[model samples]
Target: MLYVFLSICCSVIVSVLLKLAKRYQIDVFQAITWNYSMAILLTWFFFKPTIPSLQNAPIHIYLGLGVLLPLLFMVMATSVRVAGIVRTDVAQRLSLFIPLLASFLIFGDSLNKLKVIGLIIGFAAILCSIPWQKKTANRKVYSNAWIFLLIVFFGIGIIDILFKQVALFKEVPYTTSLFLIYILAFVIALIVLIFRVATKKTKFSWPHIMFGWILGVANFGNILFYLKAHTSLSKSPSTVFSAMNIGVIALGTLVGLVVFNERLSILNKVGVALAVIAIVVITIS
Candidate 1:
């Protein structure tokens, strides 16, 4: 239970940190690049994943995630900044529906009644959670925020499915596979950073390194504590899953409303309520 609590805190804190990045003048791209460097170090120290032979490793999935993780991370940062934490977090949690949809449509799983209902509610939740506002002078700018939210919803969903593939590959320890994926992601991020710096798009900033390490710590802590929660409650995998999704949504809402002073419409609140209900229904079904 403590692990679950810590994991939830860490998850929400990541959003809060990203939310503060702009205020602190942190370079998000450089910070993200350094974030992977810190994550690699933490993955080694904590998980100590043994480097297995790469001959049978799932390199393709790793490469895909390597590309998507950093890219979507930037998208998520943008979403947090524009759409606010409440809507962004809800969208991320509800992304579970993507893999659930894949299971039914692509993997030939049965479309049971409960799952059908859950999916319907989940779809509604997404629509309601969108940060729809009245048409103002900057209506076009505000409307574009939803596009970032949509990208995060789909991007994270695809990343989740790829991670499921990594989990299915038993030839290597999951932690070891994670380490290699982090290395690949770091390399790609570094390449892009180098290019941007060379082209004078963005100069190097030391502040990004410090902020990135902090972000990495929170990011890695979220994973670590979540895994510990699962291990601690080995008999209740569903409990861990449900708690993680619901907890992040709930806590993130609190932070966004109280700490960040983010406003949501009545419909947005209803969507958040439905998102929680959908998680419970999906978990039980």
Candidate 2:
């Protein structure tokens, strides 16, 4: 449970850093690129993951997820910028359902009646936590944005499944898998950053680099502890799934409320409340 809570906290801190990036005039892409570099270096320093063992493991999963992480991140960025933050966030959070379902169907994880109820409530809580407002002005509809949102939703769920699959590998160290993916993602993000700068689309900034380091530490912690939680709760991936998602949404909501003074609508309040309930129920089970 310590691992679970620490992982959740790290996830929320990552979100907060990203949210604050705009206010500080930080280049988020650059920060993310540097973040990958920092994560890779830090992961090596602390975990010292054995690399050669990966040669015997499934290389495709590592490469597939390496490419998918940034692709999905870009999809999520487009979804948020075009659709609106609330919808994008809810869709992203609700993505746990994909892996949660896969847990039973693919991994043979089980759920009892209480667990099922908790999951249903957790889903509802995610929906409610995100506020929806009717557009006051009639604007052009871009169905493409909706498509991108679906891509992000399912795409992240697929990532979750991949991570779980990696955890199942008895031979490959989870940190080694993460280290490889981080290197791949860094290469991709570096290329993007360089191209964007060369095209005069973005300027290099020091603040972004600094924030990226901070983000890297937190992001690495998030993945490390999350993977550890899976190893800790090996028999109940579903519990960790539901708990992690709901806990992030619910606790992230509290941070936004108390720390940032963000206002939540009545529905959002109800959703946060239910999120708490879902976490409690799932934990007890």
Candidate 3:
């Protein structure tokens, strides 16, 4: 339970940092790029994963995750800045439903009654989470903000599915696969950042690098503690899963409301509640 608590805190902290990034003028792209370097270092230090032969590795899954992870991270940062942490966190947690849908539609899993109900509610939650009003004079609010949330929902869901595939690739150690993916993602981010610097679209900033490493630590801590929670509660994967998602949503809402004073409409509030209920139903089913 301590691990679960820590994991939840780390997850929320990532959002908090991203939210603060805008206030501090941190370059999100440079921060994100350097984040992968820290992640790579931490992966090597903690996991000490053996380098696997590339010939037998699942390169396709690696390629997909390598590209998507960093890209979606930038999207998520944008979402937090624009949509606020509460909605962004809920959208991310609800994204688990995406893989569930894939399990039924693509992988031929049998859907239960509660799953059906959860899916219905989850979709509604997504729809309700969207800020559908016209753009306000407030620069913080974007018109059709749902696009960022939806992209995060689908992108993360697909990434989760790809990670599942990585877990199933018995030929390579999972940590090794993770290490490879981090390296690839860092490479991709680096290329883009280098291009931006070269084209004078952005300049090299020490602040972005420093903040990126901090973000990486929080991001890595979230994964590390979450995995530890699962290992500690090995007999109850469902408990860990439910607790992690529910905890993040609950804590994120508190932070967004109390700390940040993020505004949410009545519909968005209802969507948050439904998102929680949907998670519970899905877990129970």
Candidate 4:
């Protein structure tokens, strides 16, 4: 329970840090790069995943997640800045729609009444979460913001799907696989950072350093405690997953509303509220 609580707190805090990073004009990519680097270090230190045991591990998935994670993270940063944390987080949480649909269509899993209702309301939540205010980001830009959110939604869903697949392979320890994935992410991010530096697209900034450290610690804490939550509630994976998603949505909405002063239409709040209910319905179903 404590692990779940910590995971939720750290998850929201990462978004809060990203919001603060924008306010401080910190480079998102740099911060994200450092984030993966430190997260890898922490994963390795605590898990101490053995390398030789990875001889038969799925290299493709590691590479795929490595490259995709950083790219999706970049999308998330843009979404957070333009769409506000509340809507961005909602989009992310709503991404469960993809996998839920996959369960019925691809995996032939039964969808119960609760899941059916959850699906209908989830659609409404996605629409309502989009920003309509012109000055918030302009209609045109908000339209593009939807693009970012969609990419984030689909990308994260894909990542989740891959992890679900990885669960079938009992050969490699998941912790080791996770560590390698972050290593790949770190490498890809470093290459991008080097290229951006060469083109003068971003410069070395001290705030990036400070913010990156903070983001790293928070990001790693989120993942660490999330895994812990599953261990602590090994019999109830659904509870862990549902609680984490709902906790992030609820807490993120509060942060955006109270701390960041994010303006949302009445419809937007309703969508967020519906999203919370939808997630619970789907998770339990």
Highest TM-score against the true fold, candidate: 2
Please provide TM-scores, in order, for all candidate models, with all chains considered together.
0.77, 0.94, 0.75, 0.77
Residue pair clashes in candidate 2:
none
* lDDT over C-alpha atoms for residue 82 of model 2: 76
Task: Summarize candidate 3's per-residue lDDT along 88-167 as a digit string, tens digits.
Answer: 76688677676665655654456567767866776676666656553444456577678999999899888856765665
Against the hidden true structure, what lDDT does model 2 obtain? 0.85
RMSD of each: 4.5, 1.7, 4.7, 4.1
lDDT of prediction 4: 0.73
lDDT, residue 152, model 1: 90
lDDT of 2 by residue, 1-285 (tens): 677889999999999999899788788778888998999999999989877755588798888788887777778778877777767776888788799988889888887999899999999998887667544244443677789889988998988888778877778888888899899988998888889999999978888888999999999999889888888887888988889888998889999999899888899899999999998888887
Candidate 4 per-residue lDDT over residues 1-285, each given as its tens digit: 677779889989998998788787788889988888888888888889888655688888888888888888878878877667656766777776665555445444555677678667666766665554424344234656778888888998777556544544458766777788878888999998999999999987877876887798898888667666655554444445445665566567767889989777897798689777766675666
